[model samples]
Target: IPFGFYLFLKTENYIVGWIATLLTGLMVLYAVYTKSLAAWVSISVEAIVFISILIYLVKTGKYQFKIKSRLYALVLTFTGFLLLINIDSGGFNLKFGGLSDQVTSVQEFVQSKSSSGVDVVRSDAAVKGQSSIEWRWSVWLNSMAMIKDNPLIGVGAGNYKIEYPLYNHKVVRDTKFNLESQLDRAHNDYIQAAAEFGITGFVIALWAVVCFYYILFCLFKSDLSDLPGKKLLLAAALMSAGTGMLFNAGFSFPFQRAIPPFIVMLIFAIACVMHAQKIKTSHTSIIDTRLLYAVTFVFTLLFFYIGHYHYTMIKADKYFGRTIRCYNNGNWPQLLNEADKALSYNAGRKRVLFYKGFASNELGKIKESIQYYEELIQYFPNYINGLLNLGIAYGKVGENAKAVETFKKIIVLMPDEGGYYSDAGHYLTKLGKLDQAYTYLKKGAELEKENAIILLNFGVLCMQMKKYSEARKVLKKVAELEPDWDQPKQYLKYIKEQT
Candidate 1:
């Protein structure tokens, strides 16, 4: 009966279970981290849990079922009620989640880097994905559709961006708005796998997880001291990771993070190995030293393989560092050389392609730059930097329509502010979409009313649209804002001549 009870307890206390319990608290804490009072209940609940665990460990000299747990539970319940009161009183923007709001700062940083020619090439994908309620819905649907088309083998690893647009017609029927344009990635792991590796790779990955859990189960069944406690902790950690995965497909760079999963995997793998060896020793009639030597040899080989994987990635990172130095120093040829070296180790990396494209563009290798941009977009379609550069490359080839369409995508993805809108407006005006151009220019001017450049652009757009009175109004504002600014004076001259 005790054994049965333990099994039931074990099943209920699985890693996923602990994660679910903690996720609400994590979300609440994330909000709190960003200074939102809406997370007070979550914070209180987390505090209660933390304190309860500490008290139980301290008072009972046992790991479970203590006064501390009861106290925490009580605090959590009380905090949840208080949370309702806080939200009702504060009119929060539900669409603007804490994660999305954070992206604006990142977007500003990326823009600044781009302007300073930092060669960092930070992606706007996250910012675009966060800001666009519409694009997210479209991309999610399109990604699933791509998965459905190639359910078994998938399109291939790193192929989802290339396949994204091909699957778009099913989700987005209209071509007028350029919604059918392929996103670079599914922007999701499950979807990316489904589109790239097919169901086979995904299932293999799933099987790996299942096998890992089975091994963990075996560990719990053994006579390891603190087995239950470790299981509970591992389960909690796994749950948190799994929860994060569900929302983002591991796009937050888990595979790159050196801690957390690696430590957790090592712990679990060690426990399983130890438990298996103990079980075999208990049941075996005889053991061969030769067999032991063979097993050790195999382990050594496996260790080398894992080490090589990490070493290659590290080497790639090192080469990228060199590329950054070259870019910073304005040595275009050296930047290209570093990019080539980086790609020799990790060809699938998008940032490498971004630099290659940027360097090629600067060197007047227009065709070569376009190829790199195309490759980047094919690999990472949702990546905003790639999209922007690809458009610029196309513009260099006299594909203004393609450029205009690409810029429109940027405008749709990023919030209409700063020069992003103004640049689009300027290009749209060049394309003779005077009315559309004026609207964007006006919006950009409103976002930065004090800016002499935006004000002058607005004045020029108004002149083109034949809104003479509006042109004069904007030009006069610009002149007042910056008397010495030449563009506003030139625009004022042109407007007076038209009049």
Candidate 2:
């Protein structure tokens, strides 16, 4: 609808303009009613850009803002305000469930993360459920830290995940939410760009935006009376698109996604086509009919190849999904079979390697699992789960030193994670490196105070070091934290008997 209105203004077609305006109104109303945050924000920004252009045109005496356009703009502005109110009112669920529920959900989320020793804002649990917002914040924070360190050229494109855990915030690592999962994107395009391309890339991106606006301004100022209102309309539409990109980038990595970038290119292409049509005279011959037919044939062949590639990708994805379900169910043989099928369709599928490794491990093929993990790591060295499982496989094969080294590497990759610390400490203790084990265990306990397992491990380590008082205190805290867990109580009694 936004684009259609631009086209209407450019062509001076009243029927197209009114229809586009009505559809745009309906879309805004729907976005408001559905409480789609992204849609609301983008649409509101687009409306503001359009209205700003209209105001500029009227004030500069270049064009008149008709009463109809004024009404549309006013309604759009009103809808935008309503959306803002809904957002401020916590999704406006108070009328249905009372404000107390919303308030309590926020309180619980805050308390959960705060008590877990993470000083981060927790989103409304009623809306976001558990931990996702915190996770995204962690990713953003880590990405920002990385940007500070590698401000010039970033860690490189497609390398965010490789650098993510290395720069992960301490609070994020110790939060005990989806600790096994790896974060691939920062969820903010601008931040992602800085992390991937560095300061140079960021400056380039800024320059592009500046250039876009400059071009738009030039178009607006162009004397195109022969084209009649085309320049103003085109400028407004492009401005709206630019505004949408700016706002959307704050919360989404849209540049990494397919459809958003495609739509952007399509819009530019349309603008070019329109401009070309306006400049072309009756005698203009851009291309001969034979050349046009040849170009059409080449494009058709290219599209066919692309379509076939995507079709195969879809099939491989289906097999991959089946593999995941089998893995979740502990059906190793079925998982392996499905994963093999997926790989057959797409040999470069890295996710399939993870599943294959996991399935091999479950089937007690430790060597095969190690091989799979090694291959997976060759492709994506920073894969957290692959590193973790590979370490376990090494331990199973009695490669204690290699296992300890692997765990240490994990610690370097994710320094704040209590699990990695505990694992490394446990392996060290097994290898009779009690002093090193104690150091890691103590740090793990400090970072993961509420973790019953880590606390229990730390208490045991105290007992091993013959510090009866420390053992008693640690065990008592664990018991208090997990009242129903019998293990801490058992350990506490054992410590008391030793004392």
Candidate 3:
């Protein structure tokens, strides 16, 4: 579509170009209003670039305004006015509001978290109130930290998820703020590139963008009296696409995905086609049959390799999906089988290892489960699920010391998590360390006041310590929190009998 549009522009079809621009501009405006902040920023950059090029052509007398061009121009003008009115009415305020909110959030975060390093932008308020903003900012901060730590050669491509927890801010850990999803991408392509490929990779990417615009500029300056309108329109479209990519990279990991990169490659291909046409008309050269054949063969081999890689990835994904279904259905044997199949296709998949560990635990293969969890933790030390399950496995195998230590480590990794404290306290209670148990239980209660389970446990602990009054109060609160629960009432009854 982009190539065809470019060709239309180069053929002096100003009507087509103007109509296409208007339609695309309207779509982009709608996306900005309805979609994410990154969408707004990206499309806005494209619009700016497109408009700038249009103005430049007008100033240079390259673009001659015709009667038909004015019709599309009027439509585009009306559309712009409509969008502007919508913006004024607060329909697309998220773009501006989100930015202002972020600034305020950051200021509040810094003021409250004075002790935390600048590398760590952790704030309980930000995490609780503006979770999305906080999450993105946190990821960016961690990515920058990663870049600083490995400026020459990054952590490695596709290894950000593995390395993220190591750079997780202490405030996030202390608050036990659980993100709804995994932080796979840094959410900024430039930062991700720097973190994955180091400073050299980042510079190379910048150089590519510079070269793209430089080529466009040269093309724009070329004599196009034969089809001046076509050249001007094509230049504007190309400039719009390039500028969009530049802005998108600053705030989005578009290169990590397929579609955005594909669009970019398509634009580049169109530019190459235009350049080739220019060369063909200007200079005649003898064809090198041997070079042509060699190029074809090399491309053939490259395509074959790409096909095989994608095939393997698809098989891996299929098996992984099957494994998840089995796990969800509690089919331990099927889960293990599917996980094994996935590993055969894509060895050392972290999630597959997790499933293997879980299935082993369910199958009563305690030793095997422990081994699997240990292996997983070796690769993903900060994986909460692996650590949590490993601790449970240890407890099941009568390795109380290991279990206690594992829970303690979980507390350190997620200090503000009441559940870890509660788990540790439960283990301490089993070990008859009443004082230690009380301390942890109390801390857990303080952190998660609304947790009925923690409150019930604390109440029971108080009873064990022979603090009758404390037990009564805690038990009463649990009863009130869970009105219809029989356990809290039974505990309250026991406390009454004791009194």
Candidate 4:
């Protein structure tokens, strides 16, 4: 896209540049219509470059249209653009026909939230409902604080997601903020790199950026004495691609994507080539043809190796998808097999860790299941299913104490839910900790008011403690909650006899 702009410069055809600018302006309007600030920002770079070219041409007297004519053209063009944006039948239909309402929205929101904006953002985050803007700010601030503490080698590459759940540094926060998912990216490449790579790698990255712009700077200021305007425009166009991506990367994860960062490097490489071309030295070829071919062959092999690596990774995702289908269908053996296939390609896959453990448990490999469930819990401490199933697995293997411990962790993570409390109490009964079991079961029954399963468990615990009257009351409630259940009715009859 930028190369097209460079072509106009090469031919000294400013008319084509003007045409491209006009077309791009329509895109900008559409971006506005769709409320795409990012689209507006990226395409605006071309408009800026064209404007620069226009300024350069006019100053050099190459654009000889009278000033009055230029002003009239600008007014008429802008008017038509507005009409296109606000047409009643097929246009944006924006209120008042322009971006005035957007500006007003900002002003009104700021005025309304001037004193409590931080609280508002924090309250939103408390329930996992933070807007993207607020969410990014929290993650970025927490990540930066983490980086500041570990200023040397970072949290280790690709460890940010794993680290985020345990790290609770806050810039403006609520104590109740509970992140259900670890942020996969900081959403800002610069901050993400700092948190992932630390100062050591960060400085190296900063150096590369400096070197890129330095080359661009040299190209721009180099005495192009008698050199064609083509070089200036070309340099500006190439640099525009890099700058536009740089701007996008500031607020988004362009580096995490496949293409945008590639474009940045491509432009940087082109700029380097341009800078090299300006050298005045008459240098001869430094390498023979045979060595050049050797380099080419080696690079070709490297590319193939990289391609193969990505292919295997993609194959892993394919198997993971199949594994998910099998798991959902309760096909334990197939799920286990597919999970192994995914693990073979990428051993560190987090979800696969739990899926393999779950399938192994379902297939009656209790001992093996314990190990994998333990591994999964270690990987994600706040994982509800992992903790819940791990506790159950521990109980199956007669590790009552371990089961109780795992359920205690779940209770901490989910204090409002009564199921974990009931689970903990059940294990405590097996451990003969009757008093602790009574405490947990009572809490579970209170929290899970209408949960027949919880009430039944609580009633059984009461009977075990020889409190027949309390057992009778709980059993009656369980019978009410589940009228067709034979267990509660049978328990109620037994309690009747005992009473």
Full-model lDDT for every candidate: 0.61, 0.74, 0.75, 0.74
Candidate 2: stretches off by over 4 Å:
4-22, 33-38, 65-138, 170-177, 224-226, 273-308, 450-453, 475-499
Residue-wise C-alpha lDDT for candidate 3, range 2-111, written one tens digit per residue: 33334433444666666655665555456644546567667667767776776788788787544454456547655684555356454564343244654566676566
Of the candidates numbered 1 and 3, which has the greater TM-score value?
Answer: 3
Candidate 3 — which residues are off by over 4 angstroms? 1-26, 29-34, 67-126, 170-180, 221-229, 269-305, 428-442, 455-499
**Winner by lDDT between candidate 4 and candidate 3:** 3
Candidate 1 lDDT (Cα, whole model)? 0.61
lDDT of 2 by residue, 223-308 (tens): 65634464667667877886787787787778788888887766656555555554545666666889899999999999999999
TM-score, cand. 3 vs. native: 0.74
Which clashing pairs does model 2 show?
Answer: none
Candidate with better lDDT, 1 vs 4: 4
Question: Which segments of model 4 are wrong by more than 4 Å?
Answer: 1-92, 95-129, 168-180, 281-297, 300-304, 327-333, 345-350, 360-368, 375-389, 395-398, 404-499
Angstrom error of the Cα, residue 196, model 2: value is: 1.3
Model 4's number of clashes is 0
Model 2, residue 283: C-alpha shift (Å): 12
How would you encode candidate 1's per-residue C-alpha lDDT over 1-499 as one tens digit per residue?
Answer: 1112223223444443334434544454455445432233233443444444335433544345323323453356446534533442356344333445545545754565367463322233433433333344446666677778788998887666555544544553212224334455544455576668888898887686677656645544444354545344343333233333333333322432466367547645654655565453454554788989999999999999999988988889999999989878888999999899888887756668888888999999999998988887665665567778888788778777777777776665454345667877777777888888887888889887888888888887788778999989999998898888778778778878988
Model 3 error, position 110 (Å): 14
Clashing pairs in 4: none
lDDT of 2 at 132: 42
Best candidate (score: lDDT): 3
TM-score of 4: 0.70
